[model samples]
Target: MSRTVFCRKYQEELEGLERAPYPGPIGENIYETISKKAWQDWLSHQTMLINEKHLNMMDASSREYLKQEMQKFFAGEDYDKAEGYVPPVEKE
Candidate 1:
């Protein structure tokens, strides 16, 4: 899918699903929801790749980025805030 189309579709879906992370008041911020939905889509693509290639391999950086992105999302952090947030490096 083209980047532009994917972003538009993902944003529309996120707006339809998901509730506010906090109970006080819901604002215009849609970062967490959008990030989660986008991540899920991306993961699905990766799953397809794994099934097609018969190899359980994914890039370390990409995995790390996803982890951190989810964490920030749950924390109610927007993409701008989460941009600098990186997950701890895993030692094998």
Candidate 2:
């Protein structure tokens, strides 16, 4: 059976991740509080940010920026978006 957690982003209880996303306090904290759904959402959003900003994981600053943005994204705060990205138009 899968575990459940009080999802921080959705503000409700939900199915939790199978394991920590990474090693360390941050990963532990995420494992304890973040739901799988929210984590998936973050992954998609993170991809957008990385692609939009042309971030280089090799650069410490870029990684740090993504870390900060990840925090904001989970906290339901204002987070940066990809540059020059347009939402797909809905078809009627």
> What's every prediction's RMSD, in angstroms?
13.5, 2.1
Instruction: Output the worst ten-in-a-row residue range by lDDT, candidate 1.
Output: 1-10
Q: Candidate 2: misplaced stretches above 4 Å?
A: 87-92
Local accuracy by lDDT, each model: 0.43, 0.93
lDDT of 2 by residue, 8-91 (tens): 999999999999997999999999999999999999888888887888999999999999998999999999987679866889
**How well is each residue in 4-92 modelled by candidate 1, as lDDT tens digits?**
22133234433322443334423224333444455465455445434543443377765555455544544546522323334457899
TM-score per prediction, in order, is 0.28, 0.91
Model 2 lDDT, full chain set: 0.93
Among all windows of 10 consecutive residues in model 2, the one with the lowest summed lDDT is 81-90
True-structure RMSD for candidate 2: 2.1
True-vs-predicted CA distance for residue 68, candidate 2, Å? 0.3
Task: Enumerate residue pairs that collide in model 2.
Answer: none
